[model samples]
Structures are given as structure tokens and as C-alpha cells.
Target: MQLADLRRYGASHTIIQSLRDIGIKDIYPPQLEALRLGLLSTKDSFVIASPTASGKTLIAEMAILKTIFEEVGKVIYLVPLRALAGEKYADFSRKYKPLGIKVGVATGDYDSRDPYLAAYNVIISTNEKMDSLLRHSSPWIHDITLVVADEIHLITDAHRGPTLEVVLARLRQTNPNIRVVALSATIRNVHDIARWLNARVLESTWRPVPLKEGIYFDKSILFDDGSHKEVEVATIYDPINIALSVLDEGGQALIFVNTRKSTESVAAQAAKEVGKRISDGERKVLEQASEEVLKALAEPTRICRRLGELVKYGVAFHHAGIHSRQRKIVEDFFRENRIKLLVATTTLAMGLNLPSRRVIIRDWWRYQPGYGMGPIPVMEIKQMGGRAGRPGYDDHGEAVLIAKSRRDQAFLFEKYVGGEPEQVISKLGTESALRSHILACVATFLAKSEGEILDFISYTFFAIHKDPTDILSIVREVLRFLIEEGMIKEEGGNLKATPFGTRVAQLYIDPLSAVIIRDALFKAEERDRDLTPFSFFHAISATPDMMVLRLRKRDYEKLTPHIVARKDEFLLPLPGEEDQEFLAQVKTALVFLEWIEETPEDKIVGGYHIGPGDMRALVELGEWLLYSSYEIGRVFKLRRAVKYLSPVRKRLAYGVKEELLELVALQGIGRVRGRNLFNAGYRTIRDLKKADIEALTKVPTIGKEMAKDIKRQVT
Candidate 1:
């Protein structure tokens, strides 16, 4: 359908002109189907299920613009990942800001209601963030008329899916007239989701660029259509050989592996071959990009150095281990076509728009804890393959799996190349998943009794597939746990959250984590001696919300002595000496201690066998959990624990010792700069107030502008 046809469905001339300005002359098949199903004229919800790069986002854009131009109530766009949230926020803000539409994003600090979002015409947020907003009873939520759930298929994810499901159910239940437009790339149960939402289903297999699936074995690719092509590159490494062949054909490649180590090693090998193919002009551009990646941290870690070197050859590996700044540099360079190849783990498949001309699945089996190596789900494989073809760039995309033998080749083709994506089941049925949601329901006054809680559950996708009796049993168990934990109380026949319960919900932490922190605080207060910083760090690390580091073989020997010496200082109970969980918490706590002690980033990452990115993530979570513990303490009125936690929280946030906390409070000063000024006879903000900019500039790593900023702040 022509873009102008949208005007017939109440679309304004301004909206149609905006589409024209962006060069969108024609709508794709799935978009046309959605519009024909009363997308613009009716209040009914919709599920747009289509292949990647098939204009799924445009359909939502049409709906959003129509609502904005018509002055419909506020709009909420939910994304599955924080990276996707930022991408959408930037795109929407840039596109719609000219139309006088206010766009806002909320992805951090789950405790706040972010009342400023009320001024925004459209808001972008992650699933967890939105859920936290709802739990805090943000008043603007009642004004929302539309919500777009991007990647709705992720409701099947075990860790994050429950929150997404709960957010959708709460939004629908609160605003019966609100319209939802759910988008999914690969889902076999799209119709079931549609029925659950009482919405129309628009399912299509059309792609903007054609896709070809195949299997590679013995340097030959056998396409699913019975055609075969030979890869002439001579290399001992199969992935490098395949990637180089794609580069020879004037196209970029994405290599998908199962682990972070594999991504780096594979990219390192490919970098050698890729470097030989780059022209001098391209090399200069890549060298600049490489330097930017390397300098992302003040002190580069080992992974940073290796990644910087690889990017000089137009190759980079992506995983959660790399810091966000460096990851953004790599993504932007690849999108600009400066980076020829990207090697990544499955994280890259989570709705980033970085597409390549060819996608090579180098590993189909992933390690599952306690389950050994297992085949990846067909849905994830397809999502990775979907990154092959850029909509306007590649005429056709190739998604090929590597096979070791004839038998492996046949299995790869049968299972993945020609397979249908799996059906998505709701992951909201378990006790661990339902505990927080159930508490939130009562905390927010969404439900008052057992029947009301069950009614709320009936709105979830879980209820559609689960037996009512099974759900009832689980709900009862969650309620009992909450009651026993003193988070909820039964008054007469109604249910209400106690002050502790309300605070826990508002903190957006696991109810279990709050309980853990509460118990630790009370126990520490009962003791006589002062608690050390390691005690608070280890206490938070033991919570379910914190992602503790994995214990290595050498960690036991190195950690045993310190743990044993500090046993009395720990807030939580000590496990046996050889216990893996105890050792992991000890290791994680030590990392936090080193961070606050102003240890350099490289040494911490090197000693802990982690990437700089991992350290950054752990620090961020540690800060939040520490602050959550403080908030819990305030609720319970634990005077001593709260007094100690406030300063420790600051130390964790600035990555500085307590003595340097006042100096690090300045705008440009960090751990390095703070320490530099202290050792130079400037210990506090008073010392900075007394010094001139010239004297401050003499300190290491402090430039003239930094010095001026520091002087301006202190004065």
C-alpha cells in the first residue's frame, strides 16, 4: 500500500509527510495486514509477528504517530533490553522531537517514580523499569492509552520473562481501553498470545531481503535448496576462512559462538586474515576507531587491549564482558561499514540493529549449568540468523551453520536450516518468579485477597496454558512465604503489605534479597564489634539478585586465608571452607573491596579473571544492592547499620577509599584523579578550595580544563 493511503485511516497529512520525508513510500505486507485489521480505526490490540527486517517497527510507528497526532493519552514503548531501550529512545526522540512531541526514557534507579516522565508524550523503558514504575504507583500510568511491547516473544525467558508478562497484564487490567501492539520476530504461538490479549494477529514470513539457509562442511556450503558452493580460502580455522570469503565478496560477516572466550579467540584468528584484505585507506579509519575503543577506560584492561588490536583489522568480538562504551564504538563502526566482521556471543541477537551480509553459526551447542552441553533453541538460532541481511543494504542474506562431519551436516540442516521456531511458553509459573509479582500486586493495591490475586493471575499468559489448581497451589505457597517473612499481613479477610513489604516492592528487589539484607542487618546490630566493609559486600553478594562471580581453581587457595581471618566480621553465616557458593561470595566481596580501595581496573580484572565490563557490571549491581540494604535498614530503624551503609554506598559508587570520598565528589574527578590530588597535598574539598587551577593542573592525568572544572566546583 502507498504511504498516502494511511491518510484514509485518519492519519494526518503531517504524519504522511513525515513518512515521505523519511523515504518510506510503500508499506510492507505485514504492515498492510495490520492496518487492514483495524489497526488505525479500532481500539482492539494487535500482535504483529513477522520476520526480522520486515518492517515490524514501522507498523508500530504508524500506530504511535497516529495516536500522537490525534492527541491520544500517553504512550509507553517497552523494550526487552536496556541497549534496545536506548536505541529506540534515541531514534524516537530524534524523529519526533521536530513535531513537538516530548520523548523520555527511564532505565535506571528503579525506586523512583520519575515524575518528570509525565511531561513526555511518549516514554521508552525496559520491562523491569516499567514494572518498577507501576509498583511505585506512578500516577501518569493511568493516563496511558497505548503500549508497544517490542520482542514480546521473550516472555518465554526464565529470568526476565515474568516481569514482562506481569507488566502487560497490569497495564491491560488497569486501563481496559488501552491498546497494545505486540511485536515478535519468531513465535509459533502468536495466535495464542493474540487470544490472550484479545487482539488481532498479523503473521507473515515476508522479508525485505531474501534469506538463504545452509550448512558448511569441508570448506563447502550446501544450501537448503540443493545447491553447493566451494569456499576457496585456505586456512586451518574454518570460521576465519568463511569470514574472509565473505569479505572477499564485498560483504561483512557475523560469527556466532557459544562463549565469550570463543568470540575473542575466533575474532583474533579472523583478524589476521582480515588485516591482509584491508586497504590502507580503510586501515587508517579502523586504526582511529581502535584507539577510541582502547581509551574507553582510563586504564585499559587486557580485554580492552586485545579488542582494540582486533578492531584495527576491522574485526571485533561482542559479549557482556566488554564495557558499554567500547561495545557502542564497535556497534557504531560496524553500522557505518567500517568494521568488516563481528564475532559475538548470543547477546548480540537481543534486538540490536547491527546486521551483516552473512551470518555464520560457529557453535550450536551451549553449556548449561549442571546440564552439560545442550543444543540451542531453534528460536535463538533464527534470531542470530536474522541479523544476516540489512534491509536496504544486502539483496540477500546467508545464514549458515558449521558442521564437523556428514552426519553433523545433515543434522544441522534438518534441525535448524529447515526448522520452524519453537512455541513460546510463559515463564511466570515458578515460585521464584511469582514471589515478587504477587507481593507487588498486594503492595500496589491491585489485589486485596486470595481471589483478587488469582484474578490478576488469570490475566497473565501463564493462566491460559496452566491448570487453575496448579496456579492456585503456587500462589498460596507464595502468599504463605510472604506472610511468614512479615511482608504481608491479613487483616480480617483482606490482604495488605506491611511497611517492610511496601518498601521491598518499591526497591524493585527480590523479596528474598530484602529478607536476606534485613536478616543480616539485624544480626550485625546484635553483635558488639564494628563490621568491616567486606561484611556488607559479602552480605549483598549472597542475595539472589546479585550475580556472583564464578570460582576458579586458584580462587579457593587465595580466598581461604582471608575468609577464615574475617569470619567473625561476616554478617551472614559462614559455610564450610571448601563450599563453592561461600568461596564465590568471598571472591566477589574481595573484588568490591579492591574497587573501593582504589585498586586500578586492570589489576582487579586481571586478578579476578574477568573483563573490565564484568567488573563494571558487578560494581553497578553492588552499589544498588548496598543502597537497597540501607533503605531496608531505614525501614527497620537499624541505626548503626544504616549509618555505616551510607558511606560504604558512596565508596562503592566512586570506587574510592573513604578518605578520598570528598574529593571524588567533584564533577571531573574519579578514583585516579581523586588519589592524584590527595597524594599532591590536597586531601579534601577544602584543600581544593585553597589551591589555584595552575597548581591542580600539575597533578597527573589532570588537564587544564579538568583543573578549571574542579576549581569551579569547589569554589
Candidate 2:
């Protein structure tokens, strides 16, 4: 259908005109198929399963825009990542908010309920954030008219799939008439997902930019269709040469490496080639972007220092290890073609809009300490390929996998390049996922009995193809555990959540974590011992909600002595460990101790051999776990423990000592400035309130303007 024809499907002339203004002259085949299937005519669900760059996002935008203008209800677009949420929110707000539709975004920051979100006509959110909203029972949720689930193929992901499942299930239950539009990459058995949603399936392999998938082995590209091309490259093992080849063809390239270190190493190596070819203007843009990255650090971390070096050469690496602000700078420069080559980990495949003309997969295997090295899923291989063909960039794109020899090339091509993706299955039936979900259902009153709970879960994609008997046994076991912990009471064959259980659900914490926290508090109160921050960190780390530090053999040897010294403080005994698994909590607690003691970010990263992202994630998770632990103390009536844990949460949050809590509570001050102020004799808010700007500016980390702002806050 042409852009003008969109007016026939509830689109106004203004909307059609705006599409044309943005260079969207016509709808693709998959979108036209969706329209023909009555996508805009009724309040129905749909699964638009199509190849990447097939205009699936456009189809979703059309449906949501029309619904918001024609209907008087809120619309939600759920994505799997915070980055995607931000991207979609910016896209929708720019296009539709000018049409008088309100748009807002919610990802996380758990302190605020964000009740103001009800004022918006459209809200973009992460799946986990939407789940937390549903658990909170947001009042506006009941009025939702449309929900767009982007990357619905994530149902195969073991860790996060179940959260998406529960969130979608609850969205439907909240409003039985709500329309769901699920967008997916090409996965096998799309019909299963369509059947689960009770929606019409619109599947297509059409792409605006066609893809050429092949294997790069022994200086030649072998295509699946019996086509072969001999390419000139500088070094057989140098991925940079392939990228340089693309640059010579007047196109960009993306290199997918196996690890974060490889991402930086490859980006740096490629920059040496690309740097020799960059224009002065391009070098200036790259310089500005590199400066933005360096500005993210008070004293640049190693990742920032390396990123700064590469960006100046029109090259960048993207991974979770870099800071978010630095990541955005890299993405912006790459999008504008200032950065010619980007080396990234698998994170770049998970729904970011940065696309390239050539995608080179440097590794097809990933290493996990628990599982060792294993081949990636064919679906992941395809997802990485999807990033090659942007909607409007190139006429065609190339995706090649690196192979050492003909034997490896033949095996990889047969297993991945020439094979179909695996079917998407439900991970909701897994014990860890189901335990929290089952408790959520009972606590939120979505289900009052075993039969009701199972029936509700039966709507999940897991129940569509698998045996219900398996989930039944698991559900029963989880129910027994909940009852044993007094989280739920069974009376007259009906399950009811206790007050503590209701609070736990309201807090959006795992019930198992809550139980763990409660037991620790109970033990402390029973023993009548004073608890320290060391013990508090250990207690919180024992819960699954926080990511524990991975201890190496040397770490185990060193921390065993640390744990032995603090034996009397812990509610549970800290065992000296030989492997990472046993004394993981002790190692995590050590990190927390270092954090509150004002350890520099670089020193923390160096000591742990972790990146900036790991330290940030650990601190954030510690805040949540500590907050939950404090609340758990209330459940057990441990007043003293509550008081102790409350301040520790702030200490963890700001990476500050206890004396700096008052200063960190304000908007702009953090550990650096807070410590400076504390040492300068302005130890608390009252001290700041009474101090002059000159006195405040004498503190090393505070400037005249910042000191005035700090002084003004109290006056």
C-alpha cells in the first residue's frame, strides 16, 4: 500500500503527510498484509512475524497512532531493553505527540511509582517495568487499548522470558478487550505464538534491503546458494581487513566478537586502518564524541580510556561494560557515519537501530563458567545478521561467519547459515521463574486456588505445546514452600496472601529473597547481637535477587581469611570456599565494604578485574536487596536492624561513607563532593544550610556555582 493509501485505514491525511515528509513513501508487503488482515479495523491481537527491516515497526506505529487518536484509552509498547524503550519513546513522541497525543517512558528507578504516567496517552516501557507496574496494579492499566510487544521471540530466553510472559498475561487479564501487536524476527513455528495470543499470524521474508549470508573461509566467501566470491584481504585472520574492504566499497561494517575484551581489541586494531583514511571533518566529529566519552569519568576508567582512543579514529566498540552515557556517544557517532567500524558483543544484536552494510561474526561460540564453551543458537546467528540490512541504507547487505578451514566452514554453514532457526518455547515453566511468578499471582489475587493459578498459567506459551503435568508438580512444590514460609495461608481450599506477602509483591521483590531476608533478621533479633554493614551485605548477597561476585581460586584463598574474621557478625556461618560458588556472598560483601569506604571506581574495577558496568550493576542490585532487607526487618519486628539497614542502603547507593549520607541525599552531590564537604566541617544538612558559599567553595570537589546551589536548597 502506498503512503496515501494509509488514510483508508483510520489514518488521517496529516498522519499520511507526515509519513511522506519522513521519506516513507509506501508500505512494504508485510505491512500491507497486516492491513489486509484487518490490523486497524478491530480490537484484535496480531503476530507480525517477519524478517528484519521489513517495516514491522511501521505497522505497529500505524496501529498504535490510529488507536490513540480514535480511541480514549492508553497504549503501551513493551520492549525487552531500556535502550529500546528510550528509542521507541523518542520516535513515538516526536511523531505523535505533535498530533496532541501525550507520550511518556518508564524503565526503572524504583523510588518513584511514576503515577504521573497515567497522564500520557502512550507509554513505552521495558517488559520488567511493565511487570512491576502490573504488580503495583496501576490504575491506568485497566484502560489500555493497545500493547505492542517488540522482539516477542525473546520467549526462548530462559532468564527473562518468563517475566515477559507474566507481564503480557497480566496485561490481557487487566483488560480483556486490549489489542496486542507482537513484532518478531523470523523464527520457526510462528503459528504457536499466534495461537497463544489468539491473533492472526502475518508472516513474511521480505526485506527492504536483501541479505547475503555466507561463510568467509580461506580468502573466499561461500554463499548458501552456491555463489562464491574471492575477496582481497590484508591478513587471513584480521577481521579489520574485511571491515576495510566494506569501507572501500563506500559502506560500513559491524564486527561481532565473543567477549568484551575482544570488542575493544578489535575496534582498536581496526581504527589503526580506518584512521589513515578519515577526512578532517570526520575526525573532528569523532574527536567531539570521544571527548563526551572521557567526560563520563571523573578519572577515566580503562574502558573509557580505550573507547576515547578508538573514537578519534572513527572506530568504537559497544558492550555492557562501557558506561551508558559513553555508549550513547558511540552509538550517535556510528549512526552519523563518523564511526566506520564498530566491534561489539551480542548486546548490539538485541534491538538497537545501529545497522551496517557488512556484519562479520568473529565467533559463533560463547563461554560460560558453568557450561563451558558452546555454540550459539541459530536464532542468535540470524539476529546478528538482521543488523546488516538497515531499512534504507544499502540495496543489499552481507553477513559472514569467520571459519578457520573448510571442515569448520562446512560444519558452520550447514548448522547455521543454511539451517532454519529453532522454535520459540516458553521458559515460564522453569522452577526459578515459576516460583516468583506463582507467588506474584497469589499475592496479587490473580489466582486464589491451585486450579485457578494453573488455568491462568495455561495461557502462557509454555502450556501451548508442553505437558501441563510438569508445571503442575512444580507449582505444587512452590505453593508448599510459600505456605511453609507463612507467605500464604490455605483456608477452605482457597489460597490467600498474608500481609507480609502482599507487601513483598507490592515491593516487586522475589518472595524467596524476602524469606531469606526475614530469616536473617529473625536470627539477629533472636541472638540480640549488633549487626554491621559487613553482615548486612552478606545477608543481602545470599538472596538470588543480587548478582554475587565471581570468586577465583586466589580470591577464595584471600577471602576465606576475611570471612573467618567476621564469623560472629553473620546470622549464618560463612564457610571458607575453594570454588566461586561456595563463598560467593562473602566476596560480594567485600565489594560492598569497599564501595561504602569510598574506593575509587578504577581501583574497584582493577581489584575485581571487572568493568565499570559490573560495579554499577552490583551497586544498584545491592541497593534493591538492602532496601528489601530493611523492609523485611519490619515484617519480623526488628526495629534496630531496620534502622541499621536503612542507612546502609544509602551508603551503597552513593558509594559513600555513613557520614556523607546527608549530603548525598540531595540532587547533585555524590561521594566525591560529599566527602569533601564532610571534611570541610559542613557535615550535615544543617551545616550546609548555615554555611556561606565561600565556605562551601573551599571544599575541593565543590565549585562556587555548585556551592551556591547547595546553599540555596536549604534556604
Candidate 3:
């Protein structure tokens, strides 16, 4: 299966040369099988279940390029995460743009139809973003001839699976002839998914780099192949000792921990030993990388400082807590082999190209809210372990699980070493999951009546894996709720979304969240009560879509008084004292209040017991919800609430006080730069407009280039 062989299936000469330029000379077995199954030549769909790095992406690439060369319609590459979307976008753009292929990425603003994406030959998008585009009925969607669903196994994910399921069903429903290339990391139920999609299945356990499974106990490893090895490392810390042994063998280690704190603590602990192995040249590079991490934030938080220091020693920890830019730096450094040891949470296992020679599962058990401590799913453990080998670098990869005792070692060997991954099941059985989707069906004309809605759902993976009767009840309940809440209407055996329902669907919010917002605003108007900023923030925070801050035990006492003082100011009525959700809403709303009040990022993260990235996520979510609330208010004709929400949405996005909003609106300006200009007597855009470049350069943090750019924007 050479790159040249793809030409038999319509791969262009430029595509072959591009593959060779990137050193992709031969296709792996699974990819070869896909191609043989008419992946490129035919219009059939495929469900490819193979291990990570097994060339699943290349198969999709061949099909995508074939479509483009044949003058087929547009292509949509769907990913489960924004980071993966960005990765695919960059890779495709860099490789194919010179060949006259236009690549675009859409992972922002769920409410947008992204009409601009119509101009691209290929559009990479996260599943949720694609679903939003479908709800808005983006005209370009009709032009799509193929959809490459990366990480298609996420259809079993409880939180995000429903969206992917609905998106796939809807795409197929709208485009009856659309080709699908669904990729997954070797799930047990590949056949079930294949049956649902009516696609051919290609399953394989082959890896470009061979993987070895083992269990570690008492400085010794028992390989699943019935072999034993003794380690000479002199450290009681199991992760550190394991990492050191791998470093001695001239390979890097990726240690997976159960918690964010463990990632940092373990990386810091391993940094001491890892530092001794670094050469002076490597040390200089690591130092530069560390500085880049620090500069990712305007005012580095404590976590950022810790990560920066560890990166200097060729060690780094990664999790959702780190800012996106810093995470990119760490990923790039590790991929370049500048970082010797990388510690990360389960997020690293999802779908990223960062691979290492050794994968250490430091924590196999995680805390489940109601279930106490439970073992991680074998599927997820395998996904994490599959990242062990870097193809073309390491000949073999070791996935080691640490055990403290003989019993634990035996358990690990039997459970994970020889275990089969669980079957993929549909997670579209809950009301919260079906509400927005049902509304979207009606709003987008995918379904017009209850029977048609069920018909649309029959295409979902849920219909195949579970009893349709179960989802039938949930769907009916959701429909009733939508109608009673005035989001939809039933007239003469037909179903349709009202203007409010259409707006809610297009806004990409749960219909219940819209109901809550609309009712709160209406109540406030009827009572003729004026509300504060906290009231608006709290209203959005209580919605199901908002990921509210965790309520610590101490926060209950601390937030009670503030809640009491502002109780009357809230648009929604206060919850009872025993409601933890009430406390969370108040606490989360305060974070937003501080954000818009011009508080430093570090201070806000510290006070809220969250990471800087977490704070940023809250702000981003808050901004979207506020904007949605404003749009919903307009649909309901809540004029007063609409006026207050428009300015507040802008303030939340920039994380600045109301007075500094004008300054932050400029291209190069942010919360900090906006404040610098405001405090320097440039209070508004008008003030900056009247100033010259030289005068603007006098302000703190404003360099000559930036000053000139600012002046250019104003002029």
C-alpha cells in the first residue's frame, strides 16, 4: 500500500507528492483495508475502528481528496474537541492549501451560521459547532457530499454524545447521499455502529508502534506476555522511578493521573530527577519554552508559575486548568522531544497527536460523585495507553499500570492487561439531551410532527443500541415541556417552532434555559423591579448549559451573607438555604461580577479556587449565555432587560469595567491594555482617536508597533 497506489482510486498527483513530502510513503493495514473497501472510489460510508496512530486519518484524507479532485461537493471533517479541530485545520491547511484547497475551521460561537465557511473546500468543526450550524440551516450544508467524523466513538459519552448522535442523524437526514467516514479507537461495539450507519466496518488491533501491557509492583514489572523485569531505580515514588527507568532507556514517559493537582505535583517531583538528564543545549531550549508559558497570561497565576518552572527542567504537567496557549507550548515541546516527562489528566487521551515511548497509568481509580472510588473504564485506559508509542521514533511502546500490592498487581493484570473494552452505547435517553435536539429538528425542518420527529430519531445510534420505547417517552415529555413553555406549537396535526422556539434553537441553548430566562425577565417587568448586574449573571449561571463553579463547603458560609444582601436584587427568586445549586449560582455570578469589575485574572482565579483557564472558560460561557439571554429577551420583547444585557455581554467578553469597554473593542487591546489606556486618561475610543502614535506610545505596555496599530484602527 504505497502512496502511489492511491492514484488507482483517484488520488491526485499533487496529493501523492504531498504525502511523500511528509514521509507518508506506505499505508497501514487498516487504512489499506478501508481503501480496498472502496473508501475513495465509491460513494459508500465506512466505520473504521482501529488503534490510535493506525492511519485512520489518512484513509479519510484519501477519500476527501478524491471527492475534491472529482469535483464532488464540500467536505465536513467533524471532531469531538475544539483542539482536535484546530489540529486537523492546521495540518490540512499547511499541506493542501498550496494545492488550491481552501481549509476553514469553525469551533467558535454556537449561535452563528458561519456563512463565511461556504467559501472553503474543507471545513473542520467540533460536533457541537456543526450541530449549531445545522440548526441555523447554513446554506453550505446542502453542498456537503462527505462528512469525516473523527473520534466517532464519543457517541457513548454521556455529556457530549447526544450532540454528535443528533448531528450525524440530521446530516444524513438532510443529505440522503452524503458519505460518512466514521473513525474510532477500537471499540467493542463497532458492529453496532456500522449497522446503525449502514456502513462497512473495518476493525483492527494493529499499531504502527507495537504496544506492550504490563503491571508494576515492588520495583518489578510483570508483562502480559508472561515476562518479568527488575528495575534498578532507587525511588519510593513509583511514578518517578518508572519515569527514570524509561529515561535511562532513551524514551520519554507520559504519566496519566486522576486529578489536576496530581499532574502538577507528580511533574514537579519528577522534574528533580529529569533535570539531571538534560543537556545544556536542551536546558536553554526548555528555558525559552518556560518563558513562553509564563507570557501566556497577562498576570501569571500560581499554577502558571509552577508549570513554567517545571518546563525549564524538561518536565511539564497538562490539564484543563492551563491556558490554551500554554497547553499548546507544552504539547509542541513534548512532540519535539524537548520535554522529557509529561504528566497529564485523562484529557490528553481524547485525541491529540502527542505520543511518547512509555505511558504510565499512575492512577487507575477515580472518584465518582455518588459511586465513591471506581476504576476507569477499560476503553478510556486503552485510549490513554494507546498514546505510548510515537510512530517512526519508538519501535515499541510500554503501557504500565502501577500497583501497590500483589493483589493489586494481579487485579490490574486480569482487568486491564487482558480486558476487553466495553461496548459503545447511546447516551441520548435523557430529557436534557433531547430538548434542544427536538427543537432543532423542528426549527430546521428535519421534523414537522411527532411521528416525523421519531422518524428523524430512528436514524440515531440510540435507536439501534437501546429500546426506542425508552427514548419515545423522553421525547414526548420534552415536546410537552416545549409546548407548555411556549417554545413550540401543535396546530392541525402539524408541529412547528414559534419565533421564540426558532430563536432558542438558533441560539443553541436548551429550550428550558430559554424558558427560564424569558420567565425571569417577564416576572421582573411585571413586578416593576430594577435588577442589578448580579441578577443577570445569576440568571444565566443557573441555566443547565452553564458549567457553574463547584461549591466548596466553606463557600456556603462565605456566600450566604452576599446572597442575603442581594436577594431582592435578583430577577429569579432565591432558592432555599439547603440548595447547593443556589450557592453555586451566587458564587459563579460573583466571579463574573469581579471579571467585569476589572479584577486581575490571578486574583479572580485565586479567590474562586479555580484555574486561570477555568476563569476564562466561565467568562466565555457567561458571555455566550448573556448574549443568548439578550436575544431571547428580544424575541419576547423584553426591552428593558435587552438594553441591560447588550452592554453586559460586551463587558463579560473583555473582562473589563463598563468604562473600559470602548478601549477593549480595538483589535490589539485586552482587559489589561484597556485599563492601561483608561488610567492614562484615554478613557474612551474618542480619547485614543484624538491621540497620535507617539502620544499613545507613552502609555504603559503600549509599544511603538502596537501604538501605531491602535492609531491605525481609530483613524
| Candidate of highest lDDT | 1
TM-score of each: 0.98, 0.95, 0.97
Angstrom error at residue 203, model 3: 0.9
Q: What's model 2's lDDT at 569?
A: 84
Question: What is candidate 2's local distance difference test score?
Answer: 0.82
Q: In model 1, what lDDT does residue 420 have?
A: 88
lDDT of each: 0.89, 0.82, 0.87
Question: Which is the winner by TM-score between candidate 2 and candidate 3?
Answer: 3
Residue 432 lDDT, candidate 2, scale 0-100: 80
User: Candidate 1: where is the Cα deviation over 4 Å?
Assistant: none
Tell me the tens digit of each residue's lDDT in model 1 across 1-715. Answer: 7777786766678778877765578888888788778887777899999888888998888888777877567899999888889989999888888778899998989999999999998999999999999999999999999999999999998988999999999999999888999999768889999988998999998998999888999989998788887897667988878888888999999999999999999898888788888899999999999899987988899999999999999999999889999999999999988999999997557855778999999999998766889999999999898888887888989998999999999898889988889999999988999999999999999999999998998899998898546788889999999999999999988999999999999999999999999999998778778598988999999998999999888887999899878988898878798989888988999999999998899999989989988888899999999999999999999998999899999999999989998888888788888899999999988888999989988999898999999888877
lDDT of 2 by residue, 1-715 (tens): 6677765665677657656654577778898888778877766799998877788999887787667666777889999998888888888878776567889999976534678998998899998888888777777888788999999999888877998888888877757788889999889999999988899999898888989999987778887778987767765455778788888888899999889889987887777779987999888888888889998866578778888988999899988877777888888888888889989896557855688999999889998557988888999898898778655668888898989988999898898888999999888886788877887788778999999888888777887898666678889998998899888999888999987877787777778888878888777776656468888888888887878877665786788788668878897654545546558888888889999999987888878777787788788888988887887678768987787778889899999988888889887888887888888888889988889898888889688999888977878
Give the residue spans of candidate 3 off by over 4 A: 6-23, 369-372, 526-530
Q: After superposing candidate 2, which stretches have Cα over 4 Å from the reference?
A: 7-23, 109-113, 225-227, 527-530, 690-701
Q: After superposition, how far is residue 219 of candidate 1 from its true place, in Å?
A: 1.1
**Clashing pairs in model 1?**
none
